[model samples]
Target: MAKISLDEMNPAMKSKQEQLLGKFEKESKTRQFDHYLLAQGLYWISIIVALYHFGTSFIGYPATHLHRSLHVAMILFMTFFLYPANKKASRKSIPWYDIVLAIASLAVAAYVWIEYINFINRMGSPNTMDVVMGTILILVVLEASRRISGWPLVILSLIFLLYGLFGRNLPGIFMHRGYDWKALVNHIFINTEGIYGTSVDVAASYIFLFIMFGTVMNKCGMGRFFNDLALAFAGSSKGGPAKVAVIASGFLGSINGSAVANVVTTGAFTIPLMKKTGYSNEFSGAVESSASVGGQLLPPIMGAAAFIMAEMLGVKYSSIVVSAAIPALLYYLGILVQVQLRASKLNLEGLPKDQLPKLKDVMRERGHLLIPIAFLLYMLLFSGATVIFSAFWAIVATIAVSMARKTTRMSIRQILDAFSEGTRAVVSVAVACAVVGIIIGVVSLTGFGLNMANAIIQLGQSNLMLTLFLTMITCMILGMGLPSIPAYLITATMAAPALVKLGIPPLAAHMFVFYFAMFANITPPVALASFAAAGLSGGDPMKTGIQSVKLSLAGFIVPYMFIYNSALLLIDVTPLVALRVAITAILGVLLIGMATEGYLFKDMVWPVRIAAFLGALLLISANVVQDIIGFSLAVLVVLFQFYWKHKKQIA
Candidate 1:
């Protein structure tokens, strides 16, 4: 593969970095937009729209003719000038095909604006050009989305679009009066029911602004601050570097919204440190994979999927974050506990304090920048500010806070660059979400969603476990090739009905699908996160991916737990019961950890391993009888281990 030095990045990434660096900037890695980085920007754009859509999303932004005209002009400018001219830009020049497509898309958006304005001027059926333009717009958006992101989303969208036209041809239990060109176009364009639906709206509003918030925060050194903070706190412990990577990766992932970036940033430091500390190449890679994958589930940002959930659920983003607090905390706890156990078992110590940045000093320098995050939450809960508004001002706060100190001030150029880059970032995600809307629109129009739900229920024959297993398999397969947010979007639209039919709550059903989608990152044979870590670790990529699945065992089990014990997700938590659920869940996690690790009070014998396995399974299920059996087995294993340890000590 062609390579560039750390100092010599491609023009686009360099532009992005410079954009982020603001006024008072130090040295930076000049990264280029290799194919991989181009792809990374595609993923990051998915996040950007969500940020862009922030303020206008809730307060109501009209598609005024003036705004539409301006919007089209800007899209054209961005595609032709801004995108093509950047030094680190992909391909060094826009591909002729993309240029043509970009121009065509501008024409379509402009046509839509004109037609909508005409419609407002006169009440009439859609004209031939309007219908044609609308259909072309769908095709163009889906095509652009595919060029940038991948074909999976495009294929899925096309299937749904086809279904809209052919639903009546489907067999019984899977049929509807299919839509036609005019109807489909009207639905997709004139109304906010298809392309410009909730997905795009969310992306263009709250999600985009929040992403800008992240971009600004990055300028102020959130990533570095997080890394230094992690090093200060965890670098002195057993396997400290890996823990630091995990902690730092999670923080970065929550903000950056790309696993590849997370790995490259933190993995460079942690992978070598892990190897130097005696962690096997595969294990170290697995650790990083697990950590990066787990980061999205962490909150304030909680991945793009969180905002999508709020949109799908028709709730404020705050509610999702509040509800997610416990589950996200538990997820981090599970990873931390596993890491600590592994370190203890192997006697891995931390990096020297002298080598680590001092925690106090690092915080002292950058603590003010944290105000935006705090302000964001306050705006969400107390101020009743819509997520978009909160995010816009949060961006303002990020810039303002950074400038409070001379070291972090952002110049006008830097702030505007952040805005421009932030808008560009949303292009892929916006396109992807727009295309995925085809799937949703098709499912909703054709009744395929309901039929599929019916089909799943029939296949399970009322057996919940079988139903869940099938759903899990489906989610993993879908997620393997697609980004989790889009994967979750499709799954929630199509597969969620199955569980809802089986009497699962809407939230539970969605969360179940979300977990499996995230787990796909570690599940071989297409574990991208694992592959990235493996590249750095010099380990067998496949082995690292497989080991990652094992190390991230909770990814498999946690979904099941929440399905059975909804309290795990705060589904019906009375204070007293919530406390009990938390306790049992922790024990359940420990039991499962011991079963998987094959150790307890002492190294477990094979027979005791069997008992621990049962114990873990039983408690993880969280039924009263199973809990009793689990406790009995777990206590017996611990007692046996204690006795055996004392005997060994005496010897």
Candidate 2:
């Protein structure tokens, strides 16, 4: 709420910002070549990649194999040049061996593109040269994934690769007819089912453009505008800075789609303000982590996974957005309620009105920045445009709309910078998508997906609730230390089918898996988003993760609610049923927040907290009988809290 100028920002805050951005950005840790000529060449390579994607998005892409191969090739080439093999490697130079690998990546990609027709003609059979190329490509993809996304995904991919090759020797349901090394490599590398599969295709076509759109918007100052708008709207309310974090981070994260990165970018500004306004370090970190993670659940551009989800389910992207709307709302509602309850419990006050920006003035200065987003939504939801078309137009609209205001307009150089940044930003996601394709490749090759689904179903003893529980656990485990895109992909490919086998609708099943996959960002043990927030807030990482889980309880629960009663997802339900589910779900989230924070009208006793928790769960159940019971319990708790507050006031 305090409008501090750039000069007034302290050294500590600046240092925190740099540390967080470096850690989350991934590319920042890459070796920066000291040779000016080499660095300039690398920069041009990134720009060229961006230009390639930009041109393809409008003019039509090449064959899936050709397009995806080129996309991955460019990503790999840049990645090797930028990211050293290890942290101990010199930061100011790329090792010579890495340069060789980079060249190898390009040669392999060129092979795929040049021989696309030849490879297709060969069908399922591959030559020795094909096998060799495929093997190298597989290694390239795995290493790229490891460098960009960390080891979790790479390790997971390796496990799947080993499984594919040796499953016949394994025990029980996990066993399958084994694939030979050559067969495995060919399947995972040379074919469409492997690295060039749907996930990578989605990344190349839809996700890249959207990422570019987001980068363009950011370069044009959209992030600053969103922050200012949030401050203007919420800075005068109780827990103003915290509320601003929820709103602003949610806005930024929805577009950015990387929970850890989102936390650092928005938390850098909001966390300090929240602390200054009386929020605890851990609480401020948790709030930003929870809110930023929720952005992946937000509509229009709900992370890279959403595009993959659309591709997997063969549904319109708009459908996923529509179904996701209510759950995303409830997730944030839970966070907001907890923040507000905490503020009241501590008697925290908002910043002085004079220190806050005026809403009208903020809007007048930067209101046009919102038009591109509005145009994007209109194209997606109303015009029924394809996701790629929507995003392409959105990018154009972003650049054009920026021109309306000199203060916000991006010059030609800035536009090029936006393109380069956008391309660089997507390297992690693209590599992850390519690597996960190997998992999917193996799953399809060895029937591992179906086998795993059956095994889960058997472990649950055919009980739907038990199956859902096991799937949740699996999702959380797989999602650990991984980004949401690959996490969701792995879970959706493996666990989601089990839920579908249990008679859950496909969309609901995938959405259920998707939510839990993303919830990992706030779950303990390896909560990336939470840790990033902790860095910004200067809080204990473990405590921040725990607090994040507590604040985001609704996200963990809403997936099950919608799975149980599809009306919550607006599926197979009347308007009345939809309304009832929506209302109950929102109220349930608020109750959960009160119970988690141990405050409502006043501080609650243990018994009241237990009752509130149970009631919240019941409300989310969406059963008429459960709803009645939950409502009665909630009402009783409210009455007691109200009376207790009154008595304390009198005292």
Highest lDDT scorer: 2
The TM-score between candidate 1 and the true structure equals 0.86
lDDT per residue (tens digit) for residues 1-651 in model 2: 556422344688878877877786675676677899888888888899988988887788888788888888888998898888877888787778998999999999889777889987876788988898888988988888888777878888899998888789999988897889888877887778989887788778777887898899999888888888898899879999999999999988889888888888788788888999999999999999999999989986887556778888998877788788999999999899999999999999997888877889878888999899999989878997777777888999999999987889889999999998898888888888899899999998999889999999999999988999999999998888776777888899999999988889999999999899898888888888999899988899999999999999888888988998888889878888899989888878878988999998789999999999999989867679999999888899999999898986768
Segments of candidate 2 deviating more than 4 angstroms: 1-8, 648-651
For each candidate, the alpha-carbon lDDT, in order, equals 0.69, 0.86
Q: Report the number of the highest-TM-score candidate.
A: 2
Tens-place lDDT digits, model 1, residues 401-445 = 888876667887676567656666545455566676666666665
In candidate 2 the C-alpha lDDT for residue 303 amounts to 71
Q: Model 1: runs farther than 4 Å from truth?
A: 1-60, 64-90, 95-97, 117-125
Error of 1 at 44 (Å): 19
